[model samples]
Target: MATPLENGFSAPALRLHALDSEDLALLSAHVQDALVRVGDIAYLPAKRRFALVGSRFDWTAEMEGRLERCRAGLHFESVQRVRCARVSRDEPDAILELLAVTFEAGPEPPGGVIRLTFAGGAAICLDVECVEAQLCDIGPRWKTAARPTHELSSSESGAP
Candidate 1:
C-alpha cells in the first residue's frame, strides 16, 4: 500500500510488497550482490518476523549509477525460529546469487522454515512462526558506488 516517492533522479522509487513466501522467493532468484552486515539481520520470535536491512546491486546505466545500490529492508513475517542465525564463516558481506533461499511447508499450526542455501553447501534454516507471512520492501532508493567488473581472459580475446 506504499506509493512511489520522487528522489530528483529517474522515475520515483516505489515501495515493494510481497504478501507470501512465493513473492519473497522471486526477490532472490537473480539477485547477484547485496551489502549485508551481520548486525543488519534480525529475528523477532515474539512478532513472528525475520528482517534484513541492506543494499542490493542493480544493472543500470551510469547516469543512474550502475553500481548504485538500492537501500531496502526485507521483512519475512511469520517466522517461528531461526536455525543458523550466524554469518557464513565470519563473512560480514555475502553474494546473494551464490545463495538460494527456500521456504518449506509444514504442519497447519506451526508453519515452516526459510532455508538459506549458500555456496560450499552451507545452509541456514529459519522456522516459520506461523502458517503465512508478508514479505515487504520498505525502501528502494539508488545509492552511489563503484560498479563491479572483472578482467577478461586472454583466451577469449585471442591474444595468447
Candidate 2:
C-alpha cells in the first residue's frame, strides 16, 4: 500500500540491511571527498570517495547518498545539524510518524517516501512525514567531506 506524502507522492519499496561495509566505506569516502565540515555547503570533486563519519548504520546510508551525488556531479544545499538512522524494520510505526510529522500532516499523514540506492545498487526508500518530530528523534553529529576534495590544513585537520 502506498502511503500519503506532502506533495501527494509515494516512495518506492525499501530493503533493510542490504548495504555492506565495502559499500559504506565507498560512500563515506565520497561524502567526505571535499571538505570535512558539517552544517555548511561544500562541493565534491569528480569521482571522489565519500567520508565515513557516524554509526555503522546511518553513516552508511548517508555515504551512499554522497557517492551518488559526487559521482554524478549532483548538487544540494547544506543540511543544518543532521541526525540520521536506518529504520527499515526496527521502527515501522516510528517511520510512519516521521512521515507524518516531517510533512506536517495530522492523523491522515502528509508526505511520501524516497528511494535511496546504495553503492552496489541496493535501494532503500524512506518517508518524511513529521519533519520536526523526526528531526527531534535524532542527535547532532558531523560528517566528513569527500577524501579527494577535502580542504585540509596543517594546523586544522592535520592533513595535506
Candidate 3:
C-alpha cells in the first residue's frame, strides 16, 4: 500500500520509492533536526564515505568498515521484490531489521538479506536470492513467520 520514501524517507539523497511503515516510524522517532541517528550509519558508496543518518553526522571510518563486510566474491545482482506474511509476532520485526541493514539504513554487519513477512493473525516467511546470514548475524532482526521463503520458480528467481 504505502511506500518507504512516501511514508518518510522521501528525501533527495536516498531514493526510497517504497518504505515500510514500521521502519518509518522508528526512524521518525529517532531522528533529530540535523538528521544523525545515534547508531544508524549511512555509507555513500560513490564518495567512499560514511555518516550517521539523523544528527551530528560525520564521515567516520564507518564506510570502510562496511565495505569490508561485503561478502567475499560477492557481486551486486538485481534487487529482490518480496512479500510475505506476518505470521509470528516477531517475524515481521526481524525481517525489517535485516532489510534496513542491507539497504544501508543501519549497521553493516547486519547487511546481506532478502526476506518478507506475511501477516494476518499468523505470519509466513518468504525469502528470495539472499546471502548467507542468520546464525552468524544474530540480534533483534525479524524473520517471516511460519512460512518459509518460497524458492523462485527455476526461471524467475535466477534472472534479473
Predicted structure with the largest TM-score when compared to the true one = 1
Model 2 Cα lDDT, one tens digit per residue, 1-160 = 3323343443222222213233323433333322111222122333221211111222343534532111112121111222233323333232111110011123534333322222222222333332211011012223334322223233322111
Task: Give the range where candidate 3 is weakest over 10 consecutive residues by summed lDDT.
Answer: 66-75
**Estimated TM-score for each candidate:** 0.59, 0.20, 0.17
CA lDDT, candidate 1, residue 111? 69
Candidate 3 TM-score over all chains jointly: 0.17
Residue pairs in collision within model 1: 78-129, 79-129, 80-128, 80-129
TM-score pick, better of 2 and 3:
2
Which sections of candidate 3 miss by over 4 Å?
Answer: 1-43, 47-147, 157-160
- Error of model 3, residue 97, in angstroms: 13
C-alpha lDDT (0 to 100) for residue 77 of candidate 3: 24
Q: How big is the positional error of residue 64 in model 3, measured in Å on the Cα after superposition?
A: 36
Q: Alpha-carbon error at 34 in model 3, in Å? A: 32
Ranking by lDDT: 1, 2, 3
Tens digit of per-residue lDDT, candidate 1, span 24-56:
566654233455565677778888777776565
